[model samples]
Target: MRRTPADVWLALPQPFLASEALAAGRTYDQLRAACHRGDLTKLAPALYAVHREWADLTPAEAHRALCRAAVSSLDQVALSHLSAAVFLGLPHPAGRLGKVSLTALRSTRTSYPDDWRRVLQADMPESHLTSHDGMQVTEGSRTVVDCFRQLRLRHALAIADAAAGRGLTTPVALQAMRQFQAGWPGVLSAERGIPLVDGLRESWLESASVAVAHELGYPLPASQVWIHAPDGELVGRVDVLWFEWGVVGEADGMAKYLGAYDDDPSPTAAGQRVLLERNRERRLEGLGFAVARWGAADLRGGGDGLARHVQEARRRARPEQIRCLWRQDLKDPLQEWVWPPPTRA
Candidate 1:
């Protein structure tokens, strides 16, 4: 029987056991052959999902299916590391994925971890454990710390920033969570990177761009800044502002241009977005700001080139005809930026 698109879409939600399939009139040999031939995916020892439908899922959604399929087979294990981070909706690199991350509660024994094929293990206390629809998972802060300790500095900073940006966790709490994995090789990155995270960053690329800019030895720039005209008219909320240098930097990701945030993903919509952005940039220039915009490709090669580009833009900056808001706390890291500025600095 030929399956239609609707059939696959409907089957997506029904992750099932091999026993269930056998009971539903599917032969064991047919199931085994389908899995071996890539027609189906075995999410756990006995759990299965349609391979085509599984591939259609976003990384987080796919991991969720993987977890639900495996949850009953594995006991005393809470989702940890990247698995828990994505499950809790933390900032993750788009389209990036890994196997289900789990940590044993009482002792280290598991079906997947025992085989060492599709699961990674960490050790966490029961206190850090939480439940999601009766399935064990790590708390947000603990998951952030676990993910941060394992990911690269730029990648880790995004998770940290999202956690802080939404008030999911604080720096102090992350510091406390670090103790669980203390003295391990990867813990140092989490410690060094946590303090550098800013809640004001609005995207993974923005967070990554800041990390790259910092690595290039430039002082951290104020982010999520609102620029105003001389007559008190609103110009725009710019991404990066170095008030002293009059350099305004923008990280232009595909989501900004490709209508990822809106219902339309058409090229016409993208072109319209670009035109609107150009108009916005002209307004900022009217306010006497030099704008530096870069996308992921510009910074992919370790940002040496992006640094030079920004420095060149800095050189083009004109004398401030209209004052732009810098983080009053930029010079003082201890004082946090209270989301909306009380008054211009």
Candidate 2:
């Protein structure tokens, strides 16, 4: 059958069984035919999917599809934790097709060929569940709770920020979820992930800046602060800027500097990208902005290390800029002065 947008929208991501096909007014042959031709993707027996490729499935759409497929097995499954996270389109790891997470209330086991996760529970707390298209799921608050419990702090925070960005959850919701979690897993997870749950009102970099500040007890610098060169050309906007100290902090997430799904045909191309970043940082420094750079490693300790680097940058810049100027010569200050760090010598 020629699948229209509406048809595709109606079809779930998982494939259906012969019985399900028959129930839906489609014969077993028709369902099998669709599967054989790649028209429908079979997630498991009686679980069928008709997705628009990975790019086509929005987080909500993916979650909805997973719900339908799981529910067809007799409401025996509900998406949970990172799996629910993926369905919600939160940017955690395993962006690709990994194990699809499934949770059930009663002690009934299910089998599937595809990667599947099963969580069985007697009671999952009403506060923890939310209705999405009339199906039950771990609420956005609870999802954030589960995120830290189930994954590393950075990954959990990344998911939390993405959810916050999408308006799926709130910092207050995170706090409430933390309160409700009673077990050791819940307690520890909430501790690690709660601070990172602030609703930062800026880009991903700004969010990182907030996390770093909270983790290190350092004051956060102004985000998206504009810095200019001598000739009036915008040298660049700093990710986080210390106005008083003439220092600029930049979080260099590899996904930003290095685009995802890299297809490096030539080794020189990678080297050239590195050279370009170096040049960009050098130019920023020339604009009277002492730059402190960081990456994924800097985000370790849930942003403690990142904040320290920012602090150090501010300390170094203080001696040079007793009076901070919005307009400073676009020349290399580091070249003119030699305030060197003293070694053991």
Best by TM-score: 1
Q: Write the per-residue lDDT of candidate 1 for residues 215-321, one digit (tens) a residue.
A: 77776777887765545465677888766567789999889989889899999999999999999999887767789998877777789767876888888877445
> Which residue runs of candidate 1 sit more than 4 Å off their true CA positions?
1-27, 33-39, 42-47, 110-123, 263-269, 318-345
Would you list the clashing residue pairs of candidate 1? none
Question: What lDDT does candidate 2 reach at residue 28?
Answer: 62
Model 1 misses residue 293 by how many Å?
Answer: 0.4
Q: What TM-score does prediction 1 earn? A: 0.80
lDDT of 2 at 30: 66
Tens digits of per-residue lDDT for model 2, 1-345: 653333632453243444565665666666667667776666655566663363377555555455555555555556777777766656655344345556675657654454343554524666667767666677787777777777765567777877786788887777777777767365686776675564443444546555556556654455555454444455555666555466777777665435443666355666676787677677766655678877656776667677678767776664353322232224523112212312211
